[model samples]
Target: MEIDRLTVRFGELTAVHDLTLNSDCGEVLALLGPNGAGKTTTVETLEGFLSPTSGTVRVAGHDPVADHDLVMARLGVMLQSCRLYSAITPLEALRLFASYYRRALDPAPLLERVGLTHRRAIAWRKLSGGEQQRLALALALVGRPDVVILDEPTSGLDVEGRLLVRRIVAELRQSGTCVLLTSHELSEVEKMADRVAIIDGGRLRAVGTPAELAAADRRPEIRFSAPAHLDRAALASHLDATVTQPEPGRFILALEPTPAAIAELTVWLAERNIALSDLSTGVASLEDVFLRLTGEHQPEAKGPGQTP
Candidate 1:
């Protein structure tokens, strides 16, 4: 898959600016961005659901819009939300979707692969959200597609369901399938993606492997969690580094976390009777990089059972 200077607009609003990216066979490329960041617009263009206002897009060397049928044959899409017949059984739904493809995988084994064999006889509406997501994934694989586009593939999944998705993705990579993914799950992206593309305001901000992007942060710092009311000035004086508490109980020290520095910190804390619950020295995380690039405040934690 290749997007070269791709631009998509809706009337006067440019939803996607000049964005260029490519994902190769046997590779998973994750697209990361906040809402309304043009990730959906770009994916829709690749799926032939919308035409690019300017520039070009090619999937498997064929234009998605101009050669929709050819591209559709090799592409499997797992949307975040798709309505299935309320009463359709998982087995029945897979068989029905399988019939649409000339060269489809066996629905039974596909269902098994997604860990839905036990629930195959249950009605679609009777399945839990996680079960439904697994069934949707099975449907995507039934076509044995060369290119798979997964949207929030693990949303609402439990730990076991998430592990199943990871295993399937690993299998896909081993089979030399090109996978394009979009998700807000940064940790999963870090684990599964060969490369990650960060986009904001419809423009590509950065594209690199997780390590590469994280290592680009030259400002390495030591981060720790301790008492909330630690004297910032006193700590800074002790460590001879800049210190700030971005949040209650979380503090950042702008200094290279060398062994001597860590030892000094531990000694200072020990002398002051301050209990350090956690300490780490590293480059910024993907989430931190994302927040810096997108300039958006992180939302409060979600309640249990939230999709993301």
Candidate 2:
């Protein structure tokens, strides 16, 4: 799928402006942005739910607008919120969805894969949120589509449910299916995405692998073990960073990863007779880059978890 200079407008408000991105079989491209950043409009345009006001969108070599039926056949979309018929069982839902496609995967194995086998006979309205999410995922895969577009696929899921999504995404990539997904879970995106596109205010802000974005940001953070009352204000004055103690006996210093800064921090701690143990450094994260481009303040990441 390719979105070339795609633009969408609502009256005088331009929702997505000249957004260009491309993905192919065996790749997972994550679309990330702050609220009101036009990701929804762009994804809807690609999914054929809405026509682009300008520019072009192509899925499997056919224009989505002009070839809606063809694109719909080749694509599976999992929207953020799914409102299924209240009385339908999970088994019934999958069976109904499978009938839509010329050839669909059998629902029995899919139910097991998504951990919904136990809930297969339960009414849709009786399933828990995570179970419902898993069922929605099963429905998305029922068509055996060549392209899958998922929005917040893991939202409201438990650890096991989330792991299920990750496993499925990996399997889909291995099977050479094109996957485009969006999620607020930056940490998961950092781990799963083959490439990431960060957009803000209807414009593409950055696009790269997670490592590339972090390297470009050049804000390295040092985490270490020290007392809670380690004088964060004094440490902040020593480097171009804000130091904090998120837990007792644990300290984090955010700054540019310069040798000079490292030496200065070491020397300062030594002078104060404070033993800074378990020091570790990390590059800027997706959250950091997101905050930088979106002009929003995300809380400091909760961990490097003692460097192991």
Q: State residue 124's C-alpha deviation in candidate 1, in Å.
A: 1.1
Count residue pairs with overlapping backbones in model 1.
Answer: 0
Worst 10 residues of 1 by lDDT: 298-307
Clashes of each: 0, 0
Candidate 2 segments whose C-alpha is farther than 4 A from its true place? 220-234, 238-260, 263-282, 298-308
Highest lDDT: give the candidate number. Answer: 1
**All predictions: root-mean-square deviation over Cα?**
6.4, 5.7
Candidate 1 structure quality by residue, lDDT tens digits, 49-84: 999888999998899999999999899998869669
**lDDT tens string, model 2, 218-272?**
6567767886667766777666466656446666687665688789889989999
- Over 4 Å off, model 1: 226-250, 267-274, 297-308
TM-score per model over all chains: 0.87, 0.84
lDDT of each: 0.87, 0.85
